[model samples]
Target chain A: MSSSLTVERHPETRPPEQRTHRQVSTLPLVAPSVIALLLWMIVPLVMTIWFSFQRYNLLNPEAREFIGFGNFTFILSDPGFWISIGITILLVVSVLVITIGLGTLLAILFDQEFPGQGIARVLAISPFFVMPTVSALIWKNMLMHPVNGLFAQITRGLGLGAIDWFANFPLLAIIIIVSWEWLPFALLILLTAIQSLDHEQLEAAHMDGAKPLALFRFVMLPHLSRAIAVVAMIETIFFLTIFAEIFVTTGGGPGLATTNLAYYIFLKALLEFDVGGASAGGLIAVILANIVAIFLMRSVARNLDT
Target chain B: MGTLEMTRKNSRKWLWAVLGWLVACLLFFPIFWMFLTSFKTEVAAVATPPQLFFQPTLENYVEIQARADYLNYAFNSVAISVGSTILALLLAVPAAYAMSFFPTKRTKGTLMWMLSTKMLPSVGVLVPVYILCRETGLLDSRIGLIIIYTLINLPIVVWMIYSFFKEVPKEILEADRMDGASTQQELRHVLLPLALPGIASTALLSIILSWNEAFWSLNLTTADAAPLTAFIASFSSPQGLFWAKLSAASTLAIAPILIFGWFSQRQLVRGLTFGAVK
Candidate 1:
């Protein structure tokens, strides 16, 4: 492990006078990374703005022209845009509700000193480690498939015909897939937050004859507010751009029922090859997602201070 | 009365434990079923009345191997995941180290900016990035996949590593410098060793993210550079659906990462909750 650098035995702190220059040298260290992100991120973001103003299609290269917000207008007017927005909202909200609900419950369960806690914790968090595409495929195929899926098997076991879940409940199916991938993350964070809770407060609540729900509401909820908010913000930020899940499972199928914002932009570009319209759509989605993210990030940022 | 109350609480505890396992089973059964069905024949797989306890066979896996040599893609997955993580760490460690130990007004802003890059829809730049990759001859290559994944995982890596680095005091590095250790030497001897837990955790977390990454891997790599995710995707095509085979592919894809996650559940949980709770 100690290959190159020999450890000098004497470790001594530098004087305050000499430390300022040493600290200032950090400027050079971060510049390359910062500049790379700016060009790679913000520049393309600005180009998206530019493309939104033009009429460009990869299919018809000659049709490309400066449309002066025409692309944005068309993009906004597209019927799929609003539908996708609604579906995106539905996707985000449902995932949050399910994942956070399961997360907190599992966190509380794992928090208790119990036998097999280690294995339960492991099994509980295993879903989060799955690649999104693979998870979607698994859920779509062997789990939710009307014929061969376990969902179908279980249904038939109950003396019912198999349920075509994606065909019938595309949005719900997508919600479950994303939740399976993210629930472990929420659980991990929530459980950590729970562990940080003061035992004294819970003991006091117990002494005061507080019911379990009352103790959870009064004693635990406030303590968890920041962690919960962080969890919500983190999940929301990632959930907004979930593409592989939608792409893999339903492919926005069952008549656009599960066309989330990310998949919509993907379809516009990849399937339709409408570069300008898709770019505009991408910008629109960025704006819409940013509106949600900026608020969440702001709250998390404000909380990060304390 | 108190003894009765204690008994009530004990029974409730048992109830909660039972409830927890039940929930865990429901959540995990899909995976369990996929593994189970992988051992079943395609006929038994799609029988009208599904059977859970059929004689198992390796037919699906054998057929899967005939369809595609999975080991190659699995190897690519291993290479791409480890490669991206190492590359991301090479870049992010120094950056995180400098920012965490050396405070400035813009440090927080820089961190936020890095993380905010993730908010941008990846598909927004898909064509451009795809074009760049094509022109640069990086598309459908392990190097290319590694670069894309490194960028995707970089922000979180820096944030996690920075937070981990923050837990190590600046005074230690300062001490190293005072002992005539060069800036590079100080980082190597003091910062690196002291931050090994954070580094080890950062490596593990990045590996997990890269291993589980799907969007870029699917869109970017097709055959030559395809990873396990794409291996799973090959089961899907315009030809028609192959549910049993698809399940076999996906089960194979996730099994490695799931096993790793199960083994390191504690560390993974700790890393994911880096600054979240504290």
Candidate 2:
């Protein structure tokens, strides 16, 4: 096949005209997507930055004034802003730890030979597919309701008082719900990485009298580092912007208890009509996410070569 | 002694199997419970001890259908997801084709830049985009959502299709070119047919992501263009004792995407991780 293609291409190479034509056409072929993405990325970003520096509110559209750094100062000094930043960090870190740790364990479990393996795998991954609104509602009403929830029923059956999940442990509730949605993502990726591991290396380690812990630590851990990094970075990006689950479940509170930076910005923009403050908050979010995106982009760029 | 060892091994296998099954069931229980509750009456849905065995009824489904425009929302979801996916494909195929076959100094940077846009948190520009939508009367419109979805999924689509096109042997295209086939013919006859499966799975994954996109759908659409995500979110407020109806609504919202998701599990890992895992 290679020889025939090379022989056929020998005639086509005789013409410099067609080669230049193909090269010229490359720009037009790629121009549309590149231009569109460039506009999409730049326009809103510029507008957000501009708005962040002005004292603008949607309700009072006529009262636009350039109040440089005023919105930033106000947003920075707000108690809710500090609380939201804390919640955002806590939420992202907690969910990351839970998903990665649990995901690794589940991936290893599913790697073993078992009956109904395919069916179990399918079931395990279903939650990741469920829309965020539906998952939030299911957890909020069906599984976590103070009176009618399954946990309540179980507690009642076992002679203990039912815990009102959202009321008492709002952040933990959101964490559990978000973790449920993402744990499968981590599992699927890690499982793919594990399955790609060399079996001979493991056998050799076993032959060398390495116990299960040592083998996992030396061989499996090293192999899974790339996947683990990918999972951590990707999950951080998504977790930073987790809005719908909180929107549907707690509306960001029993009292701003579950409000992350994303929801806080949403509230400032839509509910309070504070565009300037929200834009400041929005810029802050962009900066926070960029910190993580830089790492993710570097890793993905490294993969581009192979 | 041999029999004892064999029994021990068999028991251990059973133990692992049981453990696996337990975890799977625990992970899947919320969905299963929702499915079960959707078929129950309002009274039965909220019954204490969680009625596991009740006479199943489609009353909630019927009520939701009668009261709300469930089909409208479903239609919007179908139209927006399908429309945006096709649009993304039209733009992505050419760009990915060029990037894969044609070597250039800037291609890698351009690809990385596209992905970096994806990492930009939607909230960062939510205020501006919302203002733009409101100004242009794109708010609560299908076209608005289609445009957004297309832009959002374009990077991933390009990446997926580029990877697929990379797998195609350059020899085939060169051979076709030598036969005096025009560029259109080469693409029409050689590329699309060869890349059909890749394109199809990419479309599938695109549909799933667009369908479950809750943030924009919720914030942008109020009633007219609300997709199933917004529809399910409408049940957030405790209006009546509508547990069964809410369950039914949630079930309807997720059913199609859930089925599509199961089929595209492998492509999902590939797409989400940008082929890093696969």
Candidate 3:
């Protein structure tokens, strides 16, 4: 996926006059996308920032006033805000650890010369295609339900009582559901990376009598390091903003157990109609996302250079 | 080299295959379970010690269409996803073409900046976007969803298409140019055909992502413009368990994209990773 820039300077490429003419034509062609994205990024962001400082509510539009950090102060002092931050970190970290760890193992395993490998891999990654709403409901009702769920049936068969996953462990439930959806993504990326590994390099390592674990640590793990990093960073960006799973499964409750920043803001903006408060929360989420985005952008920019 | 060693190797191969299949089935169980339940009657769906064998019925699927007007939501999903995909392509093809063929010092920065916009948490702008939509009376409209979907996905579409366009050799275009071909002629005759497969895959990815998108579809629309995402979410209410109906709806909702996803699995890595992995 290296840029085509390297190829253009080949001696037979276009003449300087034609190149300049094409460059001149490029602007009009690219302007629409640039302008559209600029508006899309700036307008809502500016509105959110402006609303964060003002006392605005959808229910009482005429009562708007400049509150000047009041919304932030309230959000900071609120216990739910702190709890949601903790839950957000927990969800993102746990999902990353599970997906990346399990993904690497699955990638290596499936990379082996096993019969039906292609079909197995296809089935394994199908969950990535399931929409968030459906995945959550499938886990909540079919697999995790206390009474009639598959897990309940298994537990009861073992003479144990059925456990209500949402009621008992809301955050864990969200983590499992989210992990199921994302593990496939990590696996897909890491597998592609691993397959690109030089077979001669692996054979040379094996010839040196490196044990299975040692070979994995020295050869495969190092080869996978960049892919794992990419997967982790990309997953972090998405996981921080996970909403529909909590919305469908727990509704951010069992007393604020599963409400990440996204759902928290959604509750404020829509349910409470507290536009100022939600906007303040919204800015906080954006700031958090930007912190992660900086690292991701830097790494992806490095790829562009290659 | 002995017979015993050959037997041991074959046994180990079988073991690995079995283990692989087991893991795959475990991961695929929930989706397969939903598929199975969709064919069962509602009562049998929730039956204790869930039924593995039963007289399969299409009642649940029938009920979904008759009671919920399933086709309306399906049509919305198709229109929003396909409409947004086409709009995104229209904007992206030109931009990607320019960026790929013409090198500028800022081109990389421009591409990176566009992707960074995608990382802007949707919730961060939810409050304002919702308000803006309401103010313009675009709320709960297909056009509204299409516009928002296109914007949200524009960066990815541009990035993917850009990478694809970068794969086309510059000599082809230059040769056409030397033949006195106009810019439009060069594009039509030289570029589009070379890049059509990439563009098609990009559009497939865009449509898949748009179809499965829950946030905007859930928030921005209700009955009038609700896509399948919102339709499935409606089942999350604490009403009596319609497990069979929910499964049927879910199966219907995901079937097309699931098949699309399977066919495009290889491209998924390239498209989703912004061409970094590939």
Candidate 4:
């Protein structure tokens, strides 16, 4: 059914016998991957469903029994769900704002012909490749530590008080760290988009007496819309599941200040061993992510289709 | 001539360059600080005034090596990353070639669906995956990590290789086919050369993904096959920051990939932007 309705591209010059066999089997050659993926996908999903329906707790195997909707109900009543939801939304939005906002501006900036541009470009993009755990540790130990951190040293030198980033604003701290890691990726994508923009069109705008602000508003922005949308979508997908940053920084501590959905589920499964709660929470998180994804993909796909 | 206007344009360019430099520094400062701290003594690393001109030493690097068997962890990282990338490429190349050159009706949906798996929070199936690994007796092994990384990185590899293969003119393949070339010959002589850059980038991307992959590494690896991520994490304890040793460990862990990325950044930049932008 899928093969019948989809846009398939077969090599044009297969032998007559080969074509006959191809005709016999209408599905494309990529079926192996699809089948592999289906198995990989279905097995886990089925396991999750099975686990969710049964009363499953890691510590209480003998007491485990079938309790349909019981785990789901308990999950619905748990107070951490609301708190984690709120935190997840805030983390997602804040990281999105900071990364994309800074990324756009940096992309425009780096789009200029500056000295040491090679090294500067590399620096701007390096954070993207750094592992999340390393970034968190670097931020936690070297930069943001209250007593011996770079921030503390600088503040004291400048005749100011040292702020404990974790203690004062744990969620904000996590947001900053994640934004740092992802900002470069956004910058690179947007910069590529900016570079792909038509220089002649900008010159034409200038010839028409359009100022810098007018050119940016009318010319550069229109070209960047799709790039921005792509960055937003991809970044959201990653940010929605940020585990290492929270795991390393606060470990979702100080009363769950920085616990997003991913880390919350992590705590449930790994720490609390609440398999049912974690599975249901994960499913809910996936749904929440998909909502944003649908809109993001539609816009980007529209651009792609063009 | 418009000499005054030319001077104004030059001045504006200079201002923009300055702003760009400022932005670059803001972006790069943390990494710069990490490098700087790597050479400082434990006390001096945390000292006030930031100790810009301290008697630089490799004390941390020494301590870090003494603390843990660094070579063992580094070797695991190398083996696992390289091994997984090769495995992923082997599977992905055939699969991607099939899809790109011979897309079926379900191609678009299938590709999108594969990509969507990446969207699923990895932690969602962490328990099942961990349990499966344990039950299968694959936990804490290099091969185990390789299998996991290969699966995680396969979707992207397929995506990249598919796009790369698409860029190859379909007519090229037909010409080969009309000449009565076998499938193996056509692929060997035709597709490989044309898509080398893409394949190289894919390999590089996979290696980097595996190298820096921390979550599964942390959860799955214990002692023997634990990679550098866990080695760095061992420095982290409830006791708080051990600046010099942690710095040394961090630097050692990140340096190889950093250098590798620097060398391959151009290909990487293009690869990362594949289909998303220019």
Candidate 5:
């Protein structure tokens, strides 16, 4: 937190009038963002909690009443709720593993001196920029469309029989799509982290007869632990609520196969119009995300102090 | 040394280069394929074995324009993303300015708390936001989306701008104050000019995030305010192989942001991780 420049003077050395004026000026400057965020956080949250306890359904407005923990109990007992939670964890963990695993290798690969490396890096990272809906549609139709998809063509050519990706492997299909979108993000971050690795250290390791695997194991991986942690934590928070890909691709179907927590809440709220049920589901998601957020905050907070 | 050793090293370099390009192409293939399909006839787009070389046509792009007002969706996307970015900057820049320049004991905690709010899942409040938007007559309105997008991105905007401002030397601000300049004058004339590049990159990052925001845009908007994200979602249903038009639309929807993303790739790491890595 300490800077080379000492901007803050001792209180007695500075004019009292100027100090108070500066302090007062900050309140107005900072108040708007704070107040807006406070309301944004509080209003919807309070309503979600309130509605979670009530017997509110958009279909039966007259049936609205104090339901106490009925909504929570209902959601907790539902098999679909547990299934969605499992899928959510699976999706998050799977994508995290694939992206970080491939990302580390790609980062090391792309980090080396190569012709057209700039263009290659740009192309490699391009998927990260794509809108989720667009990426999902591209995968769902063009690449995974069973008979006419590119994958089918490739498979048929190889005489291995075409695989109907979404139909046969709904969750796996989604995992692939989500990983494609995020792998570039992992690459971008890890590459930046890898670039910061000391070249002389690598040279020294090479001089000591370290093999490539040994260099990666001893030198590179340790340097990347913090960055990897950042990628995992940030990706987890986003992946837990991956709605658009599911919304556009499977519609949470093959009967809740792709219904992660976000899609589950959407189904309850919009599809079924179960206000209380969706609100209860929403709270569950919030709790799950907060667990990951705690670790992310700690890692990020460390950066702040430095 | 020896010519044999020199050739081996050169070959190894080429090997890495080729491997690097192969991986890059594999990753970029889907987008490239989408781009290629955009120009093909609908039949050719889904042809068995997939037509790599085909007579390209603008028919899909033209058909898409006629079928859906593609420009309307594009305009909505631009306006909403740009609107939200500007609004977030308006709110965040001043806040970040105050926090960075006039550091207090509570500033770090306040910043951290702001970021924690961002970690709250959007679905958690979907019901309430949906009902609230419906009740306030704001659902399907660009203003509603603009507001939501602004709030969603405000934390990162504030954080990015704060880090940027922190990098500015304090001596310049102190020098400005010695000349009897007011705080506003100090910010506008002195701090603003110094922090302009960082601010510009911050704006670019904000614009990119806002432009590609899917969750709120998908849930809240149906038609009138639907951005490209929602607009593209309309292609989800199987309507007897309209892959060509879908490709055209998808390509257009993602083109602008992808270009922006390429330009901001370096800033992305810094902005996304809230300057933690950099």
Candidate 6:
């Protein structure tokens, strides 16, 4: 199975002269990016791994000493670390569910014939272009503030008390903001896939007296499976390391309510100056991300063959 | 019976059109609200029931201009985003050309390896990179941030350009070779022209990504070198009654890129999904 997958994905290796030129000429052309990426990938990573085993802190530059997994043990035993891991998983999973669910519905909605479809699409995807800091601040101050926010105004108008969004629902707020940013991406991909569906099949099914639900279950859902898988894998890779939104809005606070693994490591490394502990946390993040990366790579590789 | 079916179909179409418009407005409300609030006065911006009509003011834009050097941050943003995009294209174009036309047994592995480098979370190497920047005296320099941006974006650029190059017919290059054209001559005379539109779109996407990149820009730069991302982030701290000013700054930071993004949505899906979706 593995061999066949490989054979299916890779193009046949034609003779060098027949394709372009000798391998020597092309090898040099490809060397720079490969070499830069190799160094970029290797140098800091090796340093991170090495730092994780030492008693190093940026505050005490001269007190460095070998500690041999001491940092890992400390981080593992820390409750904050576990909380962060839990929060990371929750954030990623929640955002994925919200974005995919809303995106699929939006894709179907936009697929219908409308008078101003093009303009509507252009407006709908605008949020994806806003910078993270801008979106976070807009949500925090303009929309979600307890007193002066739009939500607050609406609640008061209806004679209900205003709820402080960040203080009360920090993680959910972050998830909502992140989901808004990414929903356009999922919609664009899924809409493309839906548009590519064979119309003749849909027509035939309709002629056979299939109901809307039945048509969707039998025809549309099956066609969208690959696109859905692609969206899930790609969004997982990004949502695992969400930073800027949390950084700008809550600072991972209300006391760690929004602190995922990435912000947790940032706090250790930059704020507290604990290089050793942060490096250990960084390695753990690498491991977690790689689990998702493997699936994404396989899916992308499969797409390359066709 | 046929007239009744027509009436039902017409009503359904109207139903869908109304639903589509509603969803579009819901999705776009935040940005539209931001744009509207930018033109309101400070008191008007936070007013209850949200002022639908007010005397528009340029006071926020004027205040931002007089108090802060908005142009300086805008310059750095344009310089870094465009500069890194060009640098990445220089490195990526040749590499993509080689991998697409010359398929060695390891080419696929190499391409995937490049992509996997992107997957490694930037936080994983934040400490070492931070220390390296400090030690090398590159902590707050534009050049330093440009280099980081170039390195981070190189993989996507190479992949996007490679996909575009793959669409170029091999027979053209083979014909050039038959005419005894050197590699440089063939690339300059033949291949580059054919692939120009794809390359342009790829470059545009890279610029958009770099422009909106907040993590590194926020972390790596302080006062002198801060881009628009960092500039907007500085507004996160509570300042007494500056909603209008903040809105103006946010609008300025996102406007150019938003225009660019709308134009390149097709390339964005192709590049972002790594050609899997398109």
Q: What is the TM-score of chain B alone in each candidate?
A: 0.88, 0.94, 0.96, 0.91, 0.95, 0.96
* CA displacement after TM-score superposition, residue B77 of candidate 6 (Å): 1.1
Candidate 5: chain B TM-score equals: 0.95
Query: For candidate 4, lDDT tens digit of each residue in B143-179?
Result: 9899888878877787888777877876777788789
lDDT of 4 by residue, A107-212 (tens): 8888887567778788778887777777888898888999888888889888898989999988888888988988888888888778878788888999999998
Q: Fraction of true inter-chain Cα contacts (below 8 Å) kept per model?
A: 0.49, 0.76, 0.79, 0.41, 0.85, 0.76
| Candidate 5: tens digits of C-alpha lDDT, residues B9-58 | 89999999999999999999999999999999988998887899999999
On a 0 to 1 TM-score scale, where does candidate 5 land against the true structure? 0.96
Backbone clash pairs for candidate 1 read: A12-B175
- For candidate 3, lDDT tens digit of each residue in A1-306? 322236345322556676676688788888999999999999999999999999998899999999899999999999999999999999999999999999999998888878999999999999999999999999999999999899999999899988999999989999999999999999999999998888888988888898989999988998888888889888999999999999899999988989898999999999999999999999999999999889888778888841
Any runs in candidate 6 off by more than 4 Å, and if so which?
A1-22, B179-181
* Tens-place lDDT digits, model 6, residues B1-278: 99999999999989988998898898889888888899999999999878988999888888877888888888999999999999999999989998887767788899889999988988889988998999999897888889899999999999999988887777777778789998789989999999999999999988998999988888889988899999889888876867888899999999999999899988888899888787
- Cα-based lDDT at residue B108, candidate 6: 87
TM for every model, in the order presented, reads: 0.91, 0.95, 0.97, 0.92, 0.96, 0.96
lDDT of 3 by residue, B103-164 (tens): 67778888988998999999999999998999999999999999999999999999998888
Lowest lDDT block of 10, candidate 5 chain B: B166-175
Best-fitting candidate, measured by TM-score? 3
Error of 4 at B123 (Å): 1.5
Please give the range of 10 consecutive residues that has the lowest summed lDDT in model 1 chain A. A1-10
**Candidate 4 CAPRI category:** medium
Residue A152 displacement (Å), model 3:
0.4
lDDT of 5 by residue, A1-306 (tens): 223244544334556787677777788989999999999999999999999999999999998999899999999999999999999999999999999999999999999998899999999999999999999999999999898999999989999988998888999999999999999999999999998887899999999999999999989999999999999999999999999999899999899899999999999999999999999999989998999999999999988841
DockQ of 5: 0.78
Misplaced by over 4 Å in model 4 are A1-29, A296-306, B263-274
Off by over 4 Å in 1: A1-14, A303-306, B1-9, B170-185, B238-244, B263-274
Tell how far residue B260 is off in model 5, in angstroms: 0.5
Candidate 2 residue-wise lDDT, B127-243, digit = tens = 999999999999999999999999999999999998888787778888898899988899899998999999999999999999999889998999999999999998888777688
